[model samples]
Target: DTAVSQTPKYLVTQMGNDKSIKCEQNLGHDTMYWYKQDSKKFLKIMFSYNNKELIINETVPNRFSPKSPDKAHLNLHINSLELGDSAVYFCASSQVGLNTEAFFGQGTRLTVV
Candidate 1:
């Protein structure tokens, strides 16, 4: 079974459109995160949740929202998508402790025209 999974491996949309990406992890991890990899391949954490509680939230735009229905699922919703939003979005999960490894999904590539 896949440890982590995301829907719509590829997404193509126009500017000002709204879209959402769904993610789920079966590893039973206590912590989950949302990351963004830009064109330059710089990976940055956008949001983090521990046991369904918001923990870390980076300096992301208000258009980006992350929702965790439970410990195993975290979803991202983007409103009024912009060209800058085009990047690889990654969903990851970890046990939240020292030396704990994080498992990541294949990523959802979002492209805005």
Candidate 2:
């Protein structure tokens, strides 16, 4: 079974369009996160949730929103997508305090035209 899984491994959309990526973790982790890897391969955390509670939220644009309905699930929604928004989005999960080691999904590559 996959530890963390994300849907639509590849997404191609035009600017100003809105899209969403779904993620789920079956590792029974308490914390889940959303990360973005830019063209330069710089990985940054966009959002983090622990047990369905918002924990860490980076300085991302308001257009990017993360929702965690439960500890095992976290979804990302992007509004009015821009060309600069093109990147690889990764979904990760961890036990937090016990083990900060995170398991990441294959990632969803979002391309904005």
Candidate 3:
């Protein structure tokens, strides 16, 4: 009975490789988000999706793409992965217009060697 779930909990790859991480939620929420945690342990929002529509944050690099196939799923694809992209990626979900806490996935730690 997981509220949020992400695939490939650990990923290690060479530089310039393309990879994707997937996320899904069973909480019946309308909004979902992707966040990145850097090596220094700082977290930032990378992308957000509401009801299958995209709402990207300006600070995110163009190489990272978030695709929401439906309200319950949001997948992240990174092209030309770089060392700077190595981080713990998290997927979270919250109900629309609610002041409640967002549920997060276990996270996928991506390492570019």
lDDT of 1 by residue, 1-113 (tens): 99999988999999999999999999989999999999999999999999999899998898999999999999999999999899999999999888999999999999999
Off by over 4 Å in 1: none
Candidates by TM-score, descending order:
1, 2, 3
Q: Among all windows of ten consecutive residues in candidate 2, which has the lowest summed lDDT? A: 93-102
lDDT by residue for model 2 over 1-113, one digit each (tens)?
99899998999999999999999999999999999999999999999999999899898999998999889999999999999999999999999774479999999999999
The most accurate candidate by TM-score is 1
- Over all chains combined, what TM-score does candidate 3 have? 0.95
Query: What alpha-carbon RMSD in Å does predicted model 1 have with respect to the real structure?
Result: 0.5
TM-score of 2: 0.97
The candidate, 2 or 3, that scores higher on TM-score is 2
Alpha-carbon shift of residue 65 in model 1 (angstroms)? 0.7
Backbone Cα, N, C clashes tallied per candidate: 0, 0, 0
> Candidates 1 and 3: which is better by lDDT?
1
- The regions of model 2 sitting more than 4 angstroms off are none
lDDT scores of the candidates, listed in order: 0.96, 0.95, 0.92
